[model samples]
Target chain A: MPDARSTPVTAAILVIGDEILSGRTKDKNIGYIAEYLTSSGIDLREVRVVPDVAEEIVAAVNALRARYTYLFTTGGIGPTHDDITADCVAQALGVGIDVDPRARAMLLERIKEADLNEARLRMARIPFGAELIENAVSKAPGFMIENVIVMAGVPAIMQSMLDAVAPRLRTGARVTAETIEAGNLPEGGYASDLALVAKAHPGVSIGSYPSMTPAGFRNQIVVRGRDGEAVAAARAAVEALVARLHAARG
Target chain B: MPDARSTPVTAAILVIGDEILSGRTKDKNIGYIAEYLTSSGIDLREVRVVPDVAEEIVAAVNALRARYTYLFTTGGIGPTHDDITADCVAQALGVGIDVDPRARAMLLERIKEADLNEARLRMARIPFGAELIENAVSKAPGFMIENVIVMAGVPAIMQSMLDAVAPRLRTGARVTAETIEAGNLPEGGYASDLALVAKAHPGVSIGSYPSMTPAGFRNQIVVRGRDGEAVAAARAAVEALVARLHAARG
Candidate 1:
C-alpha cells in the first residue's frame, strides 16, 4: 500500500446559479477556489457550473462527491427562494435537514430575533450530522456533509468559509510550478522541442500558453509537478529549448 | 408535439486546459460564450472545465455532447503537444482525424509553407466529418462535428470563431431579462414577498442577486423568460414589492 502522505488528494468545485449561466455575473469564485486549493496542496481536478434547478444541483452533488476527495460548492445558500442548495444537498445525501442550533446562533449574530423570519431561518438549515463552517464576513454558516463542503456565492463570504474549512481537509503534496517566459517566441518554434522535454519528464506536466496582447502573442511555458525537483528539471529543459530557438533566430 | 420554434435550444461549454484547472489562466471563454449564447437564443445549461488529460477530455466531450443540444469546447487546439482537443473530440465521436486540406489552406494564410513544420501542421488537424469554424483573429480554423463545436482557448480567437458559427445554429426564442435594483433594503425584509411573486409568475425565472459593494450590499432582482410579457409582468410585481418595502421603512 502506498503511504497516506504520497496519495494525491483531489477535489471538484460545483458553482450553482442562474446568474452565472445568463452571463449577468462573471464567476470570481472558481478561479479563487482553484488557486486556494492549489496553494493548500489539494488538486482541483474539475469544475462545473450548473444553474439553480434542484435536480441539476442534486445530481451534480452526488456525481462529484463520489468522484473526488472533496466536493466544494458555492452559491444558493442565501435567504431568497432560489437559495435551495442546502435542501438539495440533503436530498443528495439522503439526510434530513432542519434549522441547526449552531447555524441559527451564527445567523443571530447578524440578524435581530424579530427579523429571523422563515426566510432568514432558511440560511440556518443544515443537513443532519453535518458540521457548520464559520463565516467571518456574513454570519450565515456554510456546512460540510460527507465529503461535500457548501459555501456562499458571494466572493468575500466564500473566501471566509474556505479559510474556516481548509484546515480540516486532507491535503496532498503541494504541487509546485515554474513558469518560463517565452516572450514573442512563437509557440511553433519551440512546440516540438517542448514536447520532447515533456515526454522525457514523466512526473511533470509542461504546457505552452499563448495569449494575445496588444503588442502581439505573448507565450508562457509552464512546468508543474508534485515533486519540486521534477518541476525544476522540466523547467530547466524548457528554458534551454527557448534559449536554443532564440540563438537560431539570430 | 410542441412547436419546434418554441422548443428551447440548450448548450454546454467544455473547457479543456490544465492551465485553467491549475489556476494558471483564469477562464475568460465561459462568460463570453455564456452571454453570447444568451443573446443568440441558446440557453447555456452547463459548463465543465477539465484538464488536458485525454481520457478526461474525451469523457467530458462525450457526456456533454449527449446531454445538451450543443456542446462547445475551448482550448487544446493549439500547436503544442498539450493541444490534444481535436484528437479527443474525434475519439469521443468515434471518427477519424487528420490534417485537412481546408484547414491547411487556412493556416497557410498566416504561416509560410516553409515554416509549416510538423508542430505548425498540428494546427491543421481536423476531424474527418467536421465543418471548419473560421477564426478572424488567427487563421487556424475551429471546427464543428454534429452538435459539438470546437474552438480556440484565446478569448479573441474564440469570440471570432463564435461569431462565425453563430449564424448557422438553430436558435430558440431569445430570453429577455429585466433587472429591478433593490437598493439598501435588506433581503430579509422582501424575501418572502419576492418568493410569492416568483410563485405567481410561472413563465418567468426570478433571481435575487446580492453583491457586496464598498458602500453596502446592492441587490438586483432579475426577471427572465422567453415571453417578454411574462418577464415584464414579473418585473412589475417585483418593482411594486420593492416600493412597498421602501414605503414601510419610511
Candidate 2:
C-alpha cells in the first residue's frame, strides 16, 4: 500500500435505529466511533442518523460509502425483525445475503445449536464476500463489505468490533490539536483578530466553543491540523491574542 | 390549518460544526431536540451533522429543507470567521442576507453601541424576508426562513430559540412511547414473538435495545406510536412475552 501518512482517509457514520429518533435511546456510538477514527488517523467528515427503514438505510449506505473512504454503521444488526441493516447493505451493494458458516460458528460460541432458532440464526446472516468482525462481548459478529463496516448498536460490542477492525484500515497522518482557554474573554472581543490569524494559517482549523456555566460563559478555542508545526503556530497566535485582550482589560 | 391530529409533521436536524465532527465536542442537541419534538407532536425523522464548509452546509440545508416539514439547524451562527451558517442558509434559499435592524436592536440590549464592533455585527446578519427566533440567553437571535429554523449551537441558547419558535410551528399528534424492561431475557429468546407483535400492530414501531451491564445484558423494548391505544397494546404484548420468558427460565 501507499505510505499511510501521505494519503487522506475520510469516513462517515450512519446510525440506523428508530429508538434513537424516538429518543427512547440516546446514541453513544457516534461520538465513540468519531473519537476512535480521529485517534487512528482517519478523519470523520459526516454523520447521519436514520430510522430502521430499509430504503433509508440502503440509500444512506450507498451515499456515504461512495463519498468517503469508509462508511461505519451502527445499530439495526440484531436478532429482531427491526434489525434489517444486513439486508439493506446487501440490497445496496446488489449482492446476495445468507447465513455465513463463519458467522454461525461465532454465534455457536455463545449459543447452543438447538437454541439457535430462526431469530437467532438471523445474527449469522452476512452479505456475500463480507468479512466478519469479532464481537468479543456478544459473539454476534459484525461484518464489512467493500467500504462499509457494519457494527452492533450496543456500545461495548461496537467498541470491540472497532478494535478488531482498526488495524486493517488505511490511515492518514494523525491530526494534532491544541486547546487555549479563552476563559471569560468573550468571542466577540477576539473574533476579528482570530479571523485574521486563521486567514494567515491556511491549513489549520480553529474553532471557538462557548458553553454556559453557573458562573457565566466559559469559552475554549481549539486549533487542529495534520501538520504539528502549523497547529503549534496557530496555538501561539491564539495564546498571544488572549493575553493581549486580558492585559487590555486589566 | 388542518386538524393537527390528522396531519403528520416531520422534522430533520442539521448540525453544522467541525468541532462535533472532529470529536472535540460531544453533541447534546440531537437527543434534546429529538425528545423535545417527540413531546411537541413533531416526528424527528432524520439527523445530519456536517462540517463548517460552506458548500456542505448549503447542500444539507437545501436537501433537508425540501424533504421534511421543518428543518432545524444548530451552530455556525456566531461572530467568528467559521460562523458561516447564516450565509449558507441564504445561499441555499437563494435569498439576500445582511445585518437586520431587528436583530441589531436585540444585540443592543446586551451590548453597548461603542462595543458593537464589526465582529459583533456579524451576529446580526439575517436572511431577507425571514422571521427572527429570539434567544433569551444571548441577545443575538436565530431566524426562520420558510421551513428551516436556524438556532445557536450553545445548548442553553438553542433551547431558548427552540422555545421561542415552537409556538409558531404546525405540529402533528403527539407520539406516545412505552418502555418495558426485559431483565435477563436474552433477545434471542423473544425476538420471534416480538416480531409478531410488531407486525400485528402496523402503525406502531417496536425496537429491542440491549446494553451490556456490569452483571449482564439489560434489554428494553420500546413501543411507540401516535395512537395511544396502539402503543399501549404493543407494550402489553411485550410485557406478556417478557413474563412468559421469565416463567420458563424459573
Candidate 3:
C-alpha cells in the first residue's frame, strides 16, 4: 500500500511507433496506462503517439515531462536502429547516454557469454543518472529519470515494469464509481436533466454511455466521485431520472 | 468485396470525450476502427483524441479531413451537453446545423410520441449537406459530410455505422501478411541481423511482437507485403534467422 496522499499526482503517456500512426498496430497501451494511473489516483491528462523519428520523440518527451508530474513512454526501446528511446531520453534531458555498467551487468546475468554481442549490448544503454526499473519477465530493465519512466512497448513487459515501479510512485485519493444502466433510452432525452443533476452535485462526474439494442438505443449514466456520500447522492439522482423515464414510457 | 483498386482509401479517427482525457474512460474505438480499415484495404493514416471542446474538435476535424481521404469521429455524438459532435462538425465545415427533418423523423419513429421532448430533439441535429449513416441498432443515424463521418463512440454503434459506410468507401489493394515466431529470444539478441533482413526485404513490413512467458521473452516477427511471393520470401528470411538463433544457443 503506497501513500495515498501524494500531493496530487498527474501523468502523461507518450506512445512511440509508426505502426500506431499508420494504423498497422492499434495501440493497446494508452488504455492500459490510463486505467493503471487512474486507479493509482494519478491524473492522466494526455496521451500522444509519435513516430520512430528521434526529433519527434525528443520534442514530445520534453513537452510532456515539462507539463505533467510524471511522463511514461512506451515503445522505441528495442535493440534495433529504430529502438532509440534510450538515446532520445538522454537528448531530451541533455544528458550523456551510454551502456551503463549496472545495466550491462544485468544483461550479462541473462545472456550467455557467447551471446553477448553488439545487438544484445544495445539493450544495456541507459541515460546518465537514471535508475533502472526492473522487468520481472525479462532481464532487460526499463529506466526512470527526473519523473519520466520509459518502459517497453510490448504490453506484458510494460505491465511488469509498471508493477515494479508501482511501489515507488506517489498516489492520491482513489475515485469511487457507480453506474446506472438506463436501458433503451436515448441519452439526449435526459441530457438537460442529467446536466441539472451534474450541476446539483458539483463533486461528482456524470458520464453517459449510449448502447444500441435490438429494440432501440440505451444509455448507462455513470456517476463518479472521490467522496462516497457525494457519489451515492449522484447515483440517487440518476435512479430518479430512470424511474421518471420508465413512468413516462409506461 | 468492395473495389479497393482505383482509389487509395485512407481514414483518420477523431476520438472525442472529456472522460477520455480525464482518464475516466479508456477508449477502445481506435483499435476496432484500425482493424476494420485494414481488412477493408483502407489505410488509416492518423488518429487524434480531442476533448469535447468545440474549438479543438473543429481544428482536428479540419486538419484530418484535409490530409486523409476520410475522417471518422467517435464519441460526443450522444444527446448530452458534452455530446456536441454535430454542432462542432457544422462549425468545422462552416455550414448551418439544425434538427434535420429526416433525422427527426427517424427519432420520432423510435421514441414514444409523448416522450419526444426538446432534449430528445437534440439527437436529430445534423450539419448541412450531410448524408445519414444508419445506426441499425439504434434509430439515430450517424452523419457524413464530404469525407467526414461522425459516429457514436460506443463500440457497437460505431461498428454498425462503419458497416453501413464501409460498403460506400473506395478501397485499395489489400496487403497480405506472414508471421514467424522466434521462441524465447529477446528481440535485442537478433536486432542487428534482423535489421539487415528487414532492409533486404524493402517492400515488406517486419513487425516484432515481444511476448513474455514463465520461461522467458519471445519475439514473433510478422512480415506484411502487398505481393504473396514477397511475403513468402520475407518469411523465409525470418525462418532462417530463427534457425540461426537456435544454432547459436546450441
The DockQ value obtained for model 3 is 0.40
lDDT, candidate 2, B1-250, per-residue tens: 7877678999999999998888888998999999999999999999999999999999999889999999999999999999999999999999999999999999999999999999999999999999999999988999999999999999999999999999999899988888899988999989999999999999888989898889999888888888898888888888998999999999
Q: Pick the candidate with the highest DockQ.
A: 1
lDDT of 3 by residue, B108-129 (tens): 7777878777777778899989
| Candidate 3 local lDDT, A1-250, one digit each (tens) | 6455445687888888756755656677887887788788887766766767788799889988998889999997778756888899999999998888888887878778687788778888999999999877667889999999999998888999999998898778877778898887657667888989989998877888766567755678888767889999999989999899878988
Error of 3 at B64 (Å): 3.5
Worst 10 residues of 1 chain B by lDDT: B1-10
Output the TM-score of candidate 1: 0.98
In CAPRI terms, model 3 is classed as: acceptable
**TM, every model:** 0.98, 0.98, 0.86
Ranking by DockQ: 1, 2, 3
Give candidate 1 misplaced runs (Cα > 4 Å): A1-5, B1-5
**Chain A agreement with the truth for model 1, given as TM-score:** 0.98
Ordered by TM-score, highest first, the candidates read 1, 2, 3
- Per-residue lDDT over A51-123 for candidate 1, one digit per residue giving the tens place of the 0 to 100 score: 9999999999999999999999999999999999999999999999999999999889989999999999999
Q: Provide the RMSD of all predictions against the true structure, rounded to 1 decimal.
A: 1.3, 1.2, 3.9
Clashing pairs in 1: none
